[model samples]
Target: MPSTPSLNDLRQQQQLAFLAQKTELRIGHAHACPLPPEHLAELDEHASEVTAVLESGLTARVFQLKLAGADYALKKARPNCLVQNLDGQTSFLNELQRRAEIDALRQRHGGFSGIVPTLYGSLAQGIILSPWLSGGTLQDWDERKLIQLFASGAELCRHGLFEWDFCPGNLIDDGRQLWLFDFGYMYRFDPLTQFNSAGQGNDVPEHHLAERIETRAYFAWLLEQEQTRGQDSALAAFRLEKEIAIEAYRKLRLELGADGANGDVLGWLDGLGQQWRQALRGDGEALYWQEGWRSHRLDLDDDIRGQTCTPRTLARCDWMLNALQGNFDALRSSGALAHETIRPERGALLDHYRRLRSQAEDFQIA
Candidate 1:
């Protein structure tokens, strides 16, 4: 059997791949809607105009630049990815590759209207430019937004692209449209056969559309509701999302089926379709509880792994602890706690969670 690549080896491989592609990485300012010359010159000079930084993070710095009576977003990559991992270090290049693919598909397929158009990019110079999305991050995910997101995600899936990161910061909504601007973590997958871009694909069926939304975005929204609006409101929101998901999946199945996709892929879709149909009609409450525990646990682990814990991370921890306190039996029965080996008493589990929350509190990213 082939040995699995170590983390260091993977990082080295990414670095080498980036170096190989570096020569072709010069900024190709968009031909259709080019950046103003003045702004380009200012960026070249690294002037005070560049100081209007909209966001600063481990991997990139995003700035809002106004020129020629229009606003543009300038994202400059860091020398080393602060994410301290292979995927993080190569994300800039990955984004460029995805944008190129998406741009080509948008021209040929005419179904990818939801993606934000990249105006310019430079892999060598570590810069990208796009029209500043004149919108806010998704706050309340109504049916329209959910449908739009899932439809776009499904389109990408059909085209062999799988987007892993569906975090709120990566999504934007104008009054008329929803946009996914970040493609850093969007990787290729086999739409005809495989599940996603991870681990031989079909091995992990749980990482599907609804799971991604729930794991990355919806759970946080639900957490907010559990705190402010209460459990009933949170449950309602989950049901609404699931209903939208069912509709979206049905549409995707039709699209892929018409295209003569592989049987395994079709079977996966049919399974989810059946599961959601049954859940919607029969035990939505149980389904909600199971998915809630999963979303909270997975998302919490992700935050902790990235060492980017926020107040929200602690809130998820709180939810987990509370669930363990009152609904531990139900949670275990639902297989939400399958990873846990020792089925401790409520007191012991509660203490364990308290320790986790305390650890998370200390790791909160500013």
Candidate 2:
């Protein structure tokens, strides 16, 4: 018998249909749109309305638009996505689909406080619009910011939407709240049965909400903290984050269990919570080092794989090389390299990272 098509496969079909113009794709608050479908279809023709243009995004060109006494973000999908991966290619369509899901989730659960509200989206027009969030990206991670982020993440996880990317560009802090505006890398999964949206869901146990945040966003910032402040400062930050994550995961596990989640899922959450709690009680420096190593290694590999490396990627490569050279024994003892198919000797590992660092420099996107 033929295997059933996955949700990803179905979404791809929907994307193709929209691209082919065989199906109309429109969602979100149409009444809140700054312009009609016709105007949005040819938004470039009305350049006078554009206040600013941000072309740095990998999948879309964003325009800050002012019209009828209001400001809005108009995200127009690029003809070709800069990130050379299948996920990047379909990101625009995936974003639209996730937005629709999020809209429904909001209606059912009142609202997701930290997620940005989509004003309008049209797949055929290759555009998405949301209110212009007036705030800068995060420069510091205080207790409040960490709490808000983890709360938002837990909420998304409960609703079965696994957000893959939490990079700086996708987040905004509007004084009052941290807003997650990007959905391009977010995917669907069974919160009651899976770790994340990757593969068979439970198969990739290493990929979870905290891991995604740490790997994609937190560790990069922590690297700067380590360089400027000291190892102690970075370790302190990691401990704080893990404490918040522990509570968040505990609450999440109870919620999922109450909603009839299976034993396996509950057990996984319990394991994570217990591990962190133990580490916190007994000087979490080793745990911090291990997770930092894993996070940087995974994120560096992701950048190289997507061919979207930046200077930050080179920095992460340097961190990994330094770790391999200076702390190879500790890294091995911590079981951080246990996941590798073949454990590389220290020399081989250094050579491997040096090559990756060169590749990162070559593929700098900005």
Candidate 3:
């Protein structure tokens, strides 16, 4: 072990770092806890079986560890987010998670397990351990692999999260299966919130319409892809996959008890289908018309104008964009786009994102 320091000193140093940066500190989680180093050392020794597995761009560190006699995920926060002043908020989050888990158990009125990560243990507001899932990520593989990822992902909501955000960064592919990992952005809206950051709670229809809009917009794009990526033999495969996905989506939604989408959701898919047919015959204007109708039809003027710079909004957008990009890349690799000269005019879409992110507040992955 390194030189032992008083817990008070550790916290004081962390406080200085946080105020200096005007943001939370994100390094050396456990040791920075408000406990004497000797005590902290004892805690480390207790969890000595844990192994450093990965580190995030944010301050949290991932560990492959054993808890409750089995493999689990241990995420130790960086010091800044768990210092003295922030401790209340941090503890509030932790307690909410405990509640989420219990509420999830109650919600299992039948066999429904809520989207809450299984909270197995916690050490102050710093480290958390959850049951390790048997899942990986969609972005971790090829087209076929990603398709597998998306297929499994569509079922994640069945586990719990309704108005969930599955960004590429938070998703984990644990080899055998794929799992939704991060809950920092989750909030119970028309769905459920396992826990929320004390300061930033949920995104209801009022505070954050951008998340759903961005979701719809991306579906608009995927509907666009399912339209453009098809033709010849690939057409058959594309339609089959889309139909499967649509069915999965429909089933998923129905399971949630929300009223069925009154074809508004499927309409974009249908329109994209028609425009794609026209594009096949070389009338590319069909797609533009369809897309223009969507901006008006979906009332996505905010996203169209790129005003969706909030964390939730951008997170959802990133999910949709990431999927489309991966699928497109796959089509090329499968020699699916070799003879096609289809020009997907997504520059406006891309430009909208650039405009939003340029504001600098929406860049939160932490």
Candidates in order have lDDT scores of: 0.78, 0.86, 0.40
Q: What is the TM-score of each candidate against the true structure?
A: 0.89, 0.94, 0.44
**Highest lDDT: which candidate?**
2
**TM-score, structure 3 vs. true:** 0.44
Per-residue lDDT for 1-366 in model 3, tens only? 775554334434554454456442222334323343233323442467665466542335566665446766666555544212433224324333433554455456533232325443343445555666655433423334334434444333344333333445455665644454555433332223311222223311222222232233333334444446732333443333344444444554555345343343334334434534545455233333333233222323333233333354444345334433544444334333332233433444445535544542533333
Number of the top candidate by TM-score? 2
Which regions of candidate 2 deviate over 4 angstroms?
1-22
lDDT, candidate 1, 1-366, per-residue tens: 997764335545866676776566544454634455334534633554553674535567777776667787777776676565667767887788889888888879787888988777877557788889888777878878888899889889889888878888888899778888888878877777787777667767778878888898988898888889988888888888988888888888888888888888889888998887787787477787789988887887777777778888888888899898888888777667766545656777688778878878877865
| lDDT-sorted candidate list, best first | 2, 1, 3
> Candidate 2: worst 10 consecutive residues by lDDT?
335-344
